[model samples]
Target: MTHSVKPRARAADKRRRLTIEAARVLHEQGVERTTLADIARAADVPVGNVYYYFKTKDELVLAALSEHSAHLDELTGRLDQLPDPRDRLEGLIRAWVDQRDVAARYGCPTGTLAVELDKRADGTLDTEAGTVIRRLLDWTGHQFRALGLPDPEDLAVTLISAYQGMSLLANALRDPDLMARQGDRLLHWLDSLQSPDPTA
Candidate 1:
């Protein structure tokens, strides 16, 4: 196979590389304690260069959230291969929990940013997370419809809400054991959804 790179592609590559390095910094430190100068130092790039790619700290945080959401998108993409709504829903629950687990292992930046969002209502970083989460739930609902569930949208909402609730609960408990238990029970609910009729 032969390949060619366009100028736009090259520019995107540079930005991606910078964003990736920044993500590592954010994961290690945190959004509140992190500064563009710190990321520039870590990335071995000039502060001006970091500013060239991202105009503000909020934009950089949004990029980190984008990176996290991209991980979710990749897992959800696998549902196309499952071919069973029941299996897909179960897989979705497991995948989402694992996403949280992995993010938790890395200090759970998504959850951290969410708390920041609440503290500063008009911070605007919420826009990216809100959109990404909605997209994830929308995709999950589509799978629910395929499984013959009634009101797939409502079911998706419930599942998403449950997952978010468990995430917050796990953060509070800080116990991996409880997280795994809640994850199993969450998937069990999805399994129950495979019935001919689902109430609520």
Candidate 2:
């Protein structure tokens, strides 16, 4: 029984490593250009082992997408622990700011993958890729709603759009400062949202 469990654990670890490496390769090279061999090399697993874990490239891509979604959930779950909704929102922006260099180099992992998959004619991969953004949107919207905002969903969209736009510009321009500056502006915007309306 112990030996069987050990092998199962090792297999699970290898599978997870493959998915993680796949996500990294996909983020760096885009989905169309990434091959199973690339992922296997990056994960330091045998190419045949990759086949054992994922029968095809699409299955591996799907696993990578799930990995991204799980990461996003963990991040948002951490942010959700903050006592203040505004603080939570600001924390989200700060996370982007912290990752600005990576975003500038490779673009937002989730964003880039989603955009690339969205171009495919089949539409299946696009749906899977979208779950990451949907989770982000839902979490952000929940923060806005908690703050008693009238247009929580709209506010969430606005914030996420700003981040995505900044990411695109930073990556296109290869300017990490652009993301940092955007983060400052977004932090100010969050503060503005919390300000008491003069009309009130």
Candidate 3:
């Protein structure tokens, strides 16, 4: 079987690469602290060239947010493919816990970025930033509902709160192990969930 090398789609590839890099820098340094120049340096694109893709800092941040949003959506869809609803929830937990080192060092990517952007003086990007968490909440709620749980929305809020709270403490205390330990506890909690009474 003969094969030929695929050619690069340079513009689209560069935009995608630059967007991912921007998301990384935004998560690590934060939206306010991160500049297009910083993202360009991280993306290895010329600073002047960045303007060709994103005209302003807000535009780049939006691109990063869009990238993050798509990632969360993809993750949720993948989780939904699990044969068991419980497994799906646990998979989501494992996904976040797998990032223990990064979470401990930089905090939860979505949580931190959402909070940072929400607290911005301008408040222009607040709603866009919040969509990340909202998407997670909605997806988690759907999973809980799939498990035949009443109060699925509430349960989803509790689970997300627990994950975000652990990330916050782990980051604040600089304790990377804390996330893993909390993840273990979360797994146990998952095991303990009983399907709520539908009639209640």
Candidate 4:
């Protein structure tokens, strides 16, 4: 008999599974150690089939990173609905901490992959990750700017930087309590930003 093509539904499902498994393997073993064969074995597909979903390991990483960024975009969008800038900042900080706690408890595939991808100065993954981050920051800054603060962008950077640093620290300590405490401190600092600057 002549060859026949698989249905599109099955192909889409396979690609979804491949992306999920690729994230898991990358999280456990890091990008370098996660061979396409490893992903195929974990996904229970032919070794050559990994290329069907992802042309390369880098594509897999970009997909995983995109997945993680979606999590932030959805959550942060809700934070934007709150009109009070200070409250929005506080809520956003806590939300971010909570997300990190859950991800850390679950092995944090995206964060794990980020460690390696971040080191590369030039790569598709790096470029995409940067875009995600800058957008998050800019959106965050918009929330503060809405409050009519004189330097909302400056305050926004301060808030985002605090969240980023505390995430890694809490992940290392594996302590949700620490994250909460640190997040509270950051929120308090954001509140202080609302006051007019010395020159203003």
RMSD of 3: 3.7
Q: Which scores better on lDDT, 1 or 3?
A: 3
Candidate 2 lDDT, tens digit per residue, 74-188?
8888988899999999899999999999999999898999899889888788887777798899889999998888789999999999999999999999999999999999999
Better of 1 and 4 by TM-score: 1
lDDT of 4 by residue, 1-200 (tens): 12335467667777877877776677667777778898889878888887878898788877667666776778777876877767777787777666766544533444446557878666547667667667777887887777677777786777766766666666677776777787778867776765556685
TM-score of each: 0.78, 0.96, 0.91, 0.76
Residue range 61-172, candidate 3, lDDT tens digits:
8898899899998988898788998999999999988998999999988889888887879988879878888989998998899898889999999999999999999999
Q: Candidate 1, overall lDDT?
A: 0.73
The model with the greatest lDDT is: 2
**Against the correct fold, how does model 3 do in TM-score?**
0.91
After superposition, candidate 1 runs with Cα above 4 Å error:
1-12, 27-29, 99-111, 197-200
Q: Which candidate is the best by TM-score?
A: 2
So what's the TM-score on candidate 2? 0.96
Q: Against the true structure, candidate 4 has what lDDT?
A: 0.71
Candidate 4 displacement at residue 36 in angstroms:
2.9
- Best of the two (1, 3) by TM-score: 3
How far is each candidate from the true structure, as Cα RMSD in Å? Answer: 4.2, 1.7, 3.7, 4.3
Clashing pairs in 2: none
TM-score of 1: 0.78
